[model samples]
Target: EVKGDGRAEDAYLLATPYNRRVAERLAGAELRLDEPPPPAAATALPNIFALYEENIGAITPLIADELKDAEERYPPQWIEAAFREAVSLNKRSWRYIHSILRRWEAEGPDYEEAGRDPEADWLERRYARGKRGAGRLR
Candidate 1:
């Protein structure tokens, strides 16, 4: 019987000895597993700047294309600075830098003026508080 979750509660009800015979005949065909096992390097590894640079170098063309129209949309210096920061901090968090770049591209002129929005502001505040608390404990 099929359940609300789309699973057959009594799957054995549909299975029979005859099903085994049919399966045996088809078993001779190469049956690749639907899902492959996880890669050997599935676990998180130490972040290395060299490895990060290699990946960034491979995607440089895409980054260049994204910045091609930046001069027309934003101040040249601000755009250059953002790109420089993104490259310099690539090893720290490329995804975060990519998100910032996307926001900058979408916001256009307002992007540079925003100056590290609420999320960054909150992080800075929290970090400052932590430092103050550590000093008090010392």
Candidate 2:
């Protein structure tokens, strides 16, 4: 449900087996979307929490290399330094940089969870087609 302040929450999400699992995962993520993202995820397997945190507003800046050989390379500090250099040079695009960061950060889950169970993406994947091309489930 959308909260009074306009932030969205699951409301009564733990109702079904699948929803319960999703809710459990969201809960376990310890997400703090109200602040900036950490340099890395908390757990050894980063991005589970990192990506979730960015879903709201938290973000960590980085300069990611374009995927070559079909492989993505996210250099943790390079983006920061690049942006820092741009700012140091008085480049007036830091805001644009952040906007790009937010957009890319939002895609983190898709990158992190490629080829995993689609059911895990139910809540946000509203209107997604079912196996039989049924109507939206979430």
- Model 1 lDDT vs. the true structure? 0.49
lDDT of 1 by residue, 1-138 (tens): 223333323323336789776656554444334447767975543232333354454446554555454435555444444545555544334455455556766775343555645446545776776865563322
Give me the overall lDDT of model 2. 0.42
**Over all chains combined, what TM-score does candidate 1 have?**
0.27
lDDT per model vs. reference: 0.49, 0.42
Best model per lDDT? 1
Report lDDT (Cα) of residue 24, candidate 2: 62
How do the residues 1-138 of candidate 2 rate in per-residue lDDT, one tens digit apiece?
323333545456547899877766666454444566658755533332232233323433432222121123444443443343334434435344354345555654232344744344443454477555677565
Point out the worst 10-residue segment of candidate 2 by lDDT.
Answer: 62-71
Candidate 2: give the clashing pairs.
Answer: 62-79, 63-79
Worst 10 residues of 1 by lDDT: 2-11
Q: Residue 30 deviation, candidate 2, in Å?
A: 29
